[model samples]
Target: MSAAAARRGAEVVLGLCAFTHDSAAALLVDGHLVGFVEEERLNGVKHTNSYPANAIAWLLDQAGLAREDVTTVAYNFAGRHYLRPLLHVPAHLVDRLTQTRAIPRARSFVTVHHRYRARMAQVRSQFPKAYLQSVLHHRAHALYAFLSSGYDEAAVLVVDSLGEIQSTTTWHANPTLQLLHAINDPASLGYAYGAITEHLGWRRGDEEGTVMALAAIGDPARFRPLMSRAIRLTRDGFALDPALLPLRVLSSRYGRVTSAFTAATCPPRRPDAQVESVHADLAAALQERTEQVMLHLAYRARGTSGSGLLCLGGGVAMNCVAVGRILQEGYFDEVHMPPAPADSGTAIGAAAAVWSDTTGRAPGGLTQRSYLGPAYPGVILSTAPRPGLSARRLTEPARELARNLAEGQIIGLFTGPVEAGPRALGNRSILASPLTDDVVKRLNATVKFREPFRPFAPVVLADKAADYFALNQLSPYMSIAVPATTLSQTVLPAVVHANGRARVQTVTQEQHPFLAELLAAFAELTGHPVLINTSLNIKGKPIAGTPELALDCLTESGLDGLLLEGWWVTRC
Candidate 1:
């Protein structure tokens, strides 16, 4: 998507991520993503979840472009126009008032106009000369998912925390995408999932995925009955009983979630901090129920729309386990999951939506690749030369890079255009042997400085993916999980999460030959084509934007070596 943006002659493209965790805006010019970063990195806060004004200014400065120079200002969501009236109603009449507020009457008219006026004012203040446009939040997700997908036509499913009022939506996309059926109501799968996240004593923005991960470790049977009663599954959608799981209950239930809220009750849990069997059971129940709901939607959409390809967006789509389950059902011929399966990717979506909608382009194409962030070369690495730089590049050296990885040496694999999405796809990644369980501890302690519970992902040779995992399809975005094959289970056990599955990135010669070659090389040495590929960042920072940043990170983290654009920076 960045490549396309850059190719389209957008000298200064500002991608805005607002009102959420790690909110940020990126700037791209002349097909080059000039400065890309998350706001959290600048704030030194984990999930520093907020709007991206600071990040936007940084990007503008980084590109030497003023706000007026920006051609367009694209926001992920329209201001919450439809909900303004509901916001003012009394607590007792909340639902009924909110329902009426949706009617778009003269009273409701204020909500829409006020929202548009306020958002436009904000945009105008930021970019007085640029055209201001608001893309529906899910549309942004769908746009990025389909545009990057490289599909001609596919079923686009968007499931996110919430976009204004929408939680889930299904779009039947042709070359030009169009909305089909959307679960725009606030009582959505994402909200239901969020409600569970609150119940589990987790932070809303930062801890939901953890709950998803924890879900796999527990049994769903014990709590299914209770959960089923709490969550009523409708034919086309699902509803949550506000009585048991109020949206605001989290603020009251957990100390971490305290904030402004109304009357809401939270069911108490056992006192154990360690993930108890009950916690696991509840997580499993949520996972199971959510997966079922998603599958139901997918099958229905596919059957009704007569489309075999599926493109999934939204935060909920980040559940690789759920994605894998969907794939195993064999309802869709192919599925594409954008790497940044969250709101952050909405920047790409916003841009793509503008391009496609304006140009009336078609859909159903797979994304070119991720390599969307900023880039740096001589500026960073040339300043220093360390040891381990003696190895020369060869014409067909896939076997060699693979050999080096198997030799217990950390290799910084910086290949072509850096990936646009969150997951590093060989272009801007730190590669290591997933077989080494100790590597996880070492990398996290020294390089990542993140929670150990967050599992590492793998980028494997596409052809070899089936041999190693339960699936044979290409998952370039690292969004789906497949059980490890016996060979992979033994060869790369550490990368496999406790659930015996891996969030896999399948590399092909077409998609990334150099990476595939490196994998092949590693396979030659280690007898495995898999390498632990993680975003190249150092604790609470955006992935390296320049060669200098990479070198600095490499040196500080005790990495074995750094393979850059053309130069190799090794440890001293």
Candidate 2:
């Protein structure tokens, strides 16, 4: 390697994903991730597509580096895909002229395209001294998953609504990643799920999880015949009918659905309307179809690559139910997904991809422990003062918190670093004893302000994971849902969902010391090592990223107390 190449390998590398949903920034030094955070966490937006300026600044400040010190800046989106919007211009004009507006307006696409270009230019101007490279969107997703899997070789699968032009892609990564098969736009499982989410009166992209939760209570057989016509599974892949599931209309939220679909199914539910049986049944059908397509792709990936391990990426991998089904099918011996398998993870992928290209070697050393964001260390009460809150330092933090939980007090936990992904593994979470019969109701109605039907997840000791859930593999990231053992269903009623499954996060002392200690203590007192673990944020907001935000959430919500670092805080 040349002198400059050696220096680049030793110096700082920045990764970013901007101008799209789940914008984020990540930093890698010597091919090891040092910092990663989502723009939504810093900006207080749920899933903002705006440029991640705040995230970039925070990562730089946290690393104690200036823009000039960065050797390379890797972007997660490819500029070559910008012209894709132009292809929809004719259809957009026709939609407007005909007054049907079944297709998204061309202006929306053009505006987004221009905005993306302008943001890219701004990024370039901001990092003039750094080498800038744009990694393909799906390629970045694949790299993140494959590298993080710690697998020498695996069958990689990337699935989302649309990454540039491709929607679903399969790869063979025998240490070196290579694309084997791809299914491009208009036939995406992600978009199909999103469209159904919107039709069920939920926000697309943001509220697909809600739809997934609702599926547990509905019967898929009610709408199976209709969905069968809308989405057809092929020998190798799947196809979506443009007439019923028009791709053009799905590009924007303002786009209209075809009258035929509305006639065949029920009318779209109003946002505030009560979710009816019909809506629930439709969600069930959509969830089932999504899983079917995912399995089909998984089988294809395994057949093509002949790899025993599978590494899944992209937004579709965030569907834990489908991921669990993939695992249960036994097509692949092992399956791995990063904590943030969605677009946020692409930031790390972008940096890793560029790092590998520059060093002529794969970027390694990423772990499943996702506590990669900023860490705040200090006296919480002295540094951040709140008018209506009182704090006291604890002698034994974990034991005290376990006792509090055993007493049925819901506690907000803010410790160490903020997690990178959406699920709060343990550091920033709401803790409650799952043995409480009314705990789920209290969490949903009083604390989280979400639909009561949405179930909470459980955090258990890693060694005791199989005792509670029928999980054959570790779920450190809460990435999959598995069937709850009979003991868990009866003992930890609050965390088990209606479908008899739970999204369980297993914690080892090596992965999360404090959480493991707390679980052990709780088990000593309550005879079960499980606790209801959910993000420390209210409805329609991002997870709390700072001590101040955690305190604010505690004051606003019905949380009994907050464990901030070594201090215990409570409302005055």
Candidate 3:
């Protein structure tokens, strides 16, 4: 082939994840990620598992491509794994027929085979000219972490509720990824944590972060023995005791812990029930146990791979507390986590995996900026003020916004491209002075409508991060927690958690110039370079994706002002 022909033959892959929470689509042009966005952001559904039709369309539109432009369509889940569940159906049925406490088992294996096949068919129909391929779920997760880490070599870990039959997988990526260990379903730290989250009166996949927050204020020793029995750590990996954790029962739509667990501990809390001290203690116990298991696995990974760096992905990695513990232990000299270290990120991984397999080269140099979603230019919003609101373009957004924040105004900031991951990262964030008294309470009650105990995160200037937080490495994506310095706890009280730690995102000029500038400007005014940063949405909603959604959030919430690209909008 001629050089031009060879270049044209390079794959344009469209990666997708559906039939699971946080469905998303990603576009990769010749193995490099060009765009990615979650379905929840576009559809306004929190943790929607529906096919990412909107996300795919938006990616193509943003890239100025057509369906025919895609040479490959890669799905983040391997449909062949449905056979495992199918094979268990007979055993489940036998248990159901015997009425030997197996009804739940039968329901758990309720065939998702047909649904998965239909979703595959839909994908094929959507991209008629493209070849469709399936990537193993955990492998996709591993590749996403390693490729985005920018590490030449690292030890990789992926822990989730269930990826096909495997729940936790370990890998060594010495520029070429290789699987080292795997723990299959029914023995997942992710499942154990989810069960505890459900038992604590929150949705499993959706509200695990709440359980993490509750853990900080509670006493882990109160329920340590019981939690240890429920999730026992082994030499290689952890195991979830079926008699206590009951993976089948917990995995069902109506999540419930086993009777043994209930007998040993307190009954499950209802969603609307008041949270008591016991519940907090249970959360703490679960968190502590999870941290222990994570550390154990990290040690094993280091010994097995002999890599000085670590990369983490999958839903379980969303537990920043556990990730923080790993960082604090210093088992690895460096740790890297992608912004979307969950199912949503599998889209990028699937595309990258397919590209590597086809081209015989890994996707190289894909920076972890995570600003690959839709971008709305500042000109998109009209200059005219809306009813009950005033709008004007700011000459110096950083200085003006810093001034507003210094005066104790909570501002909704919407600019640049929407972020691909769960973290706001300044482009789509609600910013407030972390030093403001009662700021956390006000943000939870008036703006977020979330539990009062839920703590907000802080985005700090990269150079000044270590002065405030005792993080071993920079956390550009808010991926891990770190101990707050005494100065930070005193000066930035709103962002500090009860445990005297904070999930911090450090911004450099290269990574996020606007956020860095704003932090510097705020520092000049308030003598602190940190700001209380959270997603630009209320609780139970995805972050605002568009100008209209951003405006809607501003009008609905108790925000003092909003920055819509260049325009500054405030209520009259």
Best by TM-score: 3
lDDT for each candidate structure: 0.68, 0.85, 0.85
What are the TM-scores, per candidate, against the unseen true structure? 0.80, 0.94, 0.95
lDDT tens per residue, model 2, 1-572 = 23354346466788998877888999887777778989888778888887788887777777666667788889998866755756755654565333344234344455656766787788889888788888899999999999888888999999998887688999999998899998876678887888878888989889999999999999999989878877899887998876677654334555434667778779999989998888888888888888988999999999999999999998889999999999999999989999889999999999999988888787655756488886788744752358877888899999999999999999999998889888998888999999987998899999999988999999999899999999988889998999999999877878889889999898999999899999999999998889999999999888998877888789889999999988889877
Q: Order the candidate numbers by lDDT, best to worst.
A: 3, 2, 1
- Backbone clashes for every candidate come to 36, 0, 0
Task: Point out where model 1 deviates above 4 Å.
Answer: 1-15, 22-69, 84-119, 198-202, 248-273, 356-366, 380-401, 414-417, 441-454, 538-542, 546-561, 564-572
Model 2 whole-model lDDT (C-alpha atoms) = 0.85
Please tell me which model should have the higher TM-score, number 2 or number 3.
Answer: 3
